[model samples]
Target: MILQGNDPTTGASFTLGNRLQRQLWQCVWLCLFRPSPRPLHAWRAALLRLFGARLGPHVHIYPGVKIWAPWQLSVGGHSGVADGVTLYNMAPIEIGAYCVVSQGAHLCTGSHDYNSANFQLVAHPIVLASHVWICAEAFVSPGVSLAEGAVVAPRSVVTRSLRTPWTVYAGIPARPISTRTRHGTAPD
Candidate 1:
């Protein structure tokens, strides 16, 4: 018998209609979003909003940021997604007010179930609490929650929830190393 190449173990995947809808959205993202001129944050935000993203005032989504499923995203006021940040939100992703997701940071909410024969799709929501800072190129895994005022150091890989508020985390499988008490974090 010839191999059909279809995985039977994956019971019920994305239907034809769902695939088509995603294709349409991809086209919109490629045509209208990827080509949008730089620094026009308002335009970008408006486009995301049109796509059903719940964004508060002053939410800055820079050009070149890839937002998969904007409808599942929620960004509070004064939050920013810097250039080249990829928010792969197969599940919901909430960025609270006063948060900054720096350049190249990747917030991924989708993963395949390794134990499943068909490698079924699975997802978990990510929550970045208020006043948090996800530094450049940080990789935040699915189901991770960065507490309020938490600081993820540059290039860190956060695998689990950061429960303590106001702490600095660094290194792979990020570990909190210090308590962050910033009284005006500005160059003196």
Candidate 2:
């Protein structure tokens, strides 16, 4: 589905330019210096901001995080998007306050339209609500939403809507593993 609020031409340009810039920066950093935990965060954030990323207060973006378009990323206050996380957002990617996108998680907000002869591109928005945790190696596909406090376990492939709050989702094409408190306690 064509996502609303994204102009096709503008989105294309943004995607292309942002990808090139990110790649250049990545190469430079990797070649020149090793990925150190210290100083990289500030440096990366500056680069992202230069590319028009709408980052809110105290957002901690670790090294090795790949963002397709900084202009397409909208991170709310105090969010932590960890290392090796890839945000392939051809459209908008909105991460709400205090969300934790753990290491190696992929948030893909764009895909190719297979039905068309030319293989037209299609993009969608990904929304993650406050306090959500996308665990390591989890994949959140186009247009998916992780409700507030939802937890996606490691290596889970989330291919559908996750509307339940404070629930644990696990496995490939993730299903609700259980409904429980944030600490994994059974609900009373």
Clashes of each: 0, 0
What's the TM for model 2?
A: 0.78
**Per-residue lDDT over 1-188 for candidate 2, one digit per residue giving the tens place of the 0 to 100 score:** 24333545545424554567767756755753236565566666766787778887778887667777677899987888887899888789999888889999999988867766545677779999878889999999998988888899999999888999988999988999887567642222
lDDT of 2: 0.79
Once model 1 is optimally superposed onto the true structure by TM-score, how far is the C-alpha of residue 101 displaced, in angstroms? 0.6
Q: What's the alpha carbon RMSD for model 2?
A: 5.6
TM of each candidate vs. truth? 0.89, 0.78
Q: What would the TM-score be for candidate 1 when compared with the true structure?
A: 0.89
lDDT of 1 at 156: 98
**Candidate 2 residue-wise lDDT at 121:** 71
lDDT of 1 by residue, 3-105 (tens): 1234646544556665665677788889988898887888888888888899988888887888888888999998899989999987899999889999999
Look at candidate 1 and give me any clashing residue pairs. Answer: none
